[model samples]
Target chain A: MLRALSVIVICGTAAMASSQSNPPNETRSSPATVVPQQQTPTKSTAIIGLDGVKEKTAGTLNVKDGKLCFVHSRNKSQISAAAIADVVTGEDSQRVIRGTLGTLSMFAPYESGRAISMLRSKIDILTIQYRDDDGGLHGVIFTMPVGAAEPIKQELITQGAHTTIQTAAVAARGKQ
Target chain B: MTNFFRITMCSCLFAMLSLAGPHLHAQRKDTEKIKASALKVEMIQSDQIAVPAAFQVAVYENLIQQLGKKASFLHVYRDGDRDAASIPNLVVLHTTVSRFKEGSEEMRQVTTVAGATSITIHCRFTSADGKLLLEKDVNGKVRFFGDNRKATYDFAKRASAVVSDKFSANGQS
Candidate 1:
């Protein structure tokens, strides 16, 4: 009885780990420049906060040519890294979406996908402050899963905006 | 042992989920607070505009509509009200049309289906004491398929952002 139970437990652990996320390949460090027709690109839909404005809008944060692209159903001149002057990971954002996901886990403990991320107790948000062609400063806010934080940080680093973590740890780690 | 592990994980997950309700409620309250302001929109000048007579009026009308619709503040008043300017706190706006170009038939026939239409304007926002708060040369363009006056729409859109972004309700810059 003990041996059969052990086998089941080991299998369950292996299956759970596999289901969480695929192994990070080298492509994560360098996302492809062109999106393939057959493959659907992963995306993060977020509530965008425009600087100097009191209201917020819904948009998707996408990666285009290794630079972040902010697009909505409406709006022109999609914002890209070239427009961004600073990238700040929100240090004190109260992301209610993650909290709401955690609350739902009470009824569905087996919730996977986006819910599992809320277990980390952190709402990972990327607050990008960019300048428009007119030299006006605008702010954009995006909510992303914690799993996507590293790749985004790396991408922004390539564009010259240092993530909060890397900027803080630069002294101890030297050059990255 | 397997059942015990499942029970332990489920219990932990459930407990954390239960605690999130109050936290989420607190966050909702934080974003609701907004500051309001009272602003005055003066006339949109078109003395030097080279466009058609209707085009100028259309552009002027469009700018007023956009500023009223998109900009968020305590109150927005048009210039004709004499009593409004004398109020304790009043911000007056002065605008001058700098440049304008009607849609080009050549570009529409040769390169773009819509051609290019553009407009530029200078704006100054001030307090009742005539103290200048903000001055900026705002412009807009419509190069794609759209109405020629969309250039003004574009200009108004950009100008509204300037107004909403620079000032706040408490009169603090």
Candidate 2:
């Protein structure tokens, strides 16, 4: 009886050991299984173009203060807000500025910093308007990086926009 | 012997799995970080104004000429009247200060004076309406032998060149 009991004890121990090594055939949850759950989702905002503003394939979209903001990813350095001066919505969305030649050249000093300084340029606040795909309109305030304002303005003119180059003092406080 | 072998195999498998977890997690985190740093700028509009007075106008016009077709000038009073008027891409404020003296000493003193005078212009740029695009204070020493127009013209020309270079570099029209 003592020998028989010893064999039974050894057999039971072997079975338990085998079970522990292979785990259970049923789904055995591990502490490691919860690790994936620990990862949190990261959210980012993007700006998308709508309606009159032709949407570029590579860009981002975001809504700020109730206005839709569209940013083209190709020129990652350029950022425009929904509000710009003289935004016209029709078949195409356009921003218009009316001033004399002197005003146009006034941007020189701001541009100076661009050439000599590493700091990003700051543009004054202008009005911007958004036209939705379904013909809805939204307006927002916007600022551009310095130096970029002129090129965009020029492009608008070249596109047959009636750009009026005007003269005025430098931007005044609270004017932008 | 069977029990001992089973125990050894389980321990080896756990150890390998544990080692791989951190590397996989780290790789994912790195990818998320890269997507956060990109930014872009979009332009809206610009307005520029010229300094009044004939000497200033002469100086300003000479400067505008250097800007080529990139910029133009207008009288300040008519800036707001939008009767089929074109909007300026930028606005420039020009002022001329004359100090009669000889050589660099005169220029140095004028620089200090000009610097003080520029505070108002700087403030305007900071303001919402002025939207001061650029400001350049040019000091001309009205020499007995030198033409003030020429001196002012030279200063405006240099400033315009600097501004134009910046505009082009920024990808402005």
Error of 2 at B84 (Å): 7.7
lDDT of 2 by residue, A1-176 (tens): 65565565445544543443342224333222221111121111121223233312334433333233345534332223222223321110111221253234324332321111111112222223333333322333333322223333323323333222311211221166
lDDT of 2 by residue, B135-163 (tens): 44434333322223345445545555444
- DockQ each: 0.01, 0.01
Tens-place lDDT digits, model 1, residues A59-153: 55555564665555555234566666656553112223244554453344232222332222233456665555545334455555544544564
**How far off is residue B168 in model 2, in Å?**
3.6
Q: Lowest-lDDT window of 10 residues in candidate 2 chain A?
A: A89-98
**Model 2 segments more than 4 A misplaced:** A1-176, B1-54, B69-128, B140-146, B169-173
Compared with the true structure, what per-residue lDDT tens digits does model 1 show for residues B1-173?
99999999999999988899788877766444223356666656777765443344444545555777777654666545454655656777788788877675224422445568777888988877898877889988888534355676688788877766665667443
- What is the lDDT, from 0 to 100, of the residue A24 in candidate 2? 26
Off by over 4 Å in 1: A1-176, B1-36, B105-110
